[model samples]
Target: MRPSPLLLALPALSTAQQQFPFLDQVKGWFAQASNSISSAIPSAPSPPSVPNPVASGAKVIADAKVQPLTKDNYQDVLKPGAATASPGIEEWMIFVTGGNKTCFGRCERAETAWNESTALLSASRSPPNLGLLDCEAEPVLCNAWAVGPPTIFHFLIPQPLADQSTPATTVRSFGLNRTTVTAPEIASIHLEEKYTQKEPYEGIFHPFDGPLAKAGLAIPVGYAIWGFSLIPSWAFMIGVSFISRSMMSRRMQGGAPAGGAQPAAAPAAGS
Candidate 1:
């Protein structure tokens, strides 16, 4: 193989230059070349340093239009405040799942979309009230609402009648995914009502109102019928036989009188 450039340059160095080792001079030359090459490439304009919009100590989602709601205050915020003469003004609210690994990391995108929707709605002249419930923080409340995590719910709640006695209210949910937001209508239950929201119920067995609940109940009933059908005819016969024998034994025992003596064998005829 041919000698390297460094070896070739070694022989060309003058006697005075050789006094300062050729290797040192070569290194210096390389340093200068590198600087030239770097400068020639137009050192990518250093990205202008940007000031962070939020303070280091600030909370996440501070600017979000979506209000963080809890179990205690959620009802008051979503429901009508006063007993109005006419129907209450319609309101819209969103339930979003976040924190504590609720949806296998899928909630991040969903939550982002929800926040964007809130921002969009807030700009409107008559923006509906939007409240967010974090499934991770308020799991019981989410369960009561029959809300599954990693999901976004946009509910259009029609105001209750002034004289409505029941505290319970039903809200209509619109079909919304990560990005879609639309007006809600009662007649569109088939197209948009993927899941029905059941307000929290304290009573036991109150949650068995869904189709899945019906299936759950039906499963047991089916199992019972199947079990009964499997019972052999001989088993029933055996049970009947045992009961009849018991009754007969009881009757025979009852017939034996309390005297326990034959009186005098009827005072034999010939004796």
Candidate 2:
């Protein structure tokens, strides 16, 4: 016997409900799982390249442009105005006036002696300009004490005396000193010319001497001025107050006995 239509429909509906129980909860869990899977995948990192440590060192060497010292081009990197134009009185007396007039013999000997002496003593010598503590004498000596390149000697004579000038005549003389060094160390030396004119009224005037000549003297002047200027107004006021108080105390101590000091007590009111 076949079931009636309503009973058949009722049974089919019940089966569908039973099969679909907690359908919303299942859909929600499926959505959460899909989100978690999407979040679990990580983004890839950028690719890296190998580092080259020698590149920077090579660049520094390339930038240095090491070269040999020569007469034509030795002053390229030396400090400007390092070599004095006119020799000191002692040097002039030893090498110029006392030496023979021949440019090659006594002059060359004097130069050689001076170079050797300077190279040896420079390590222990102090800078003439700044205080002794300010300089690293050894480093300066090591850096500057090199034999100069071979140079031609030229003596300049005034135009008026050129016709009568002789080789023995004292005039301006110029020569070069040579030096050699290993790779990576470059030494440059220059003779900076400073002209001095002696006027009857003005005495000796060095044309090239500039503000650097006064830098040492100006430091102390500026320091003193700065220290005085920085004194606070309160300090001045306090000084004035101390002086005023001292004056007032002295006046009170020296004043006429406060009300004339009561007549010596009147002999003790009739002894």
Q: What root-mean-square deviation over C-alphas does model 1 reach?
A: 16.1
* lDDT digits (tens) for residues 1-271 of candidate 1: 8879988776667654768787788889999999999888965678898744433112243245556767566556655443321255444556557674555655554555554444445555666555677767765555555556654454444554568643433344343453433323211222333335444333322223334333544334434544555589999899999999999999998888777755555667888
Candidate 2 has its poorest 10 consecutive residues by lDDT at 127-136
> Would you list the clashing residue pairs of candidate 2?
147-178, 147-179, 148-177, 148-178, 148-179, 149-177, 149-178
Question: How many Å off is the CA of 224 in candidate 2?
Answer: 11
lDDT of 2: 0.32
Q: Could you say which candidate leads in TM-score?
A: 1
lDDT of 2 by residue, 16-114 (tens): 778988876887999999999989998687888864554444334323422223222323212232243222211110112112312223233333433
As for candidate 1, its clashing pairs are none
User: How many Å off is the CA of 142 in candidate 1?
Assistant: 1.1
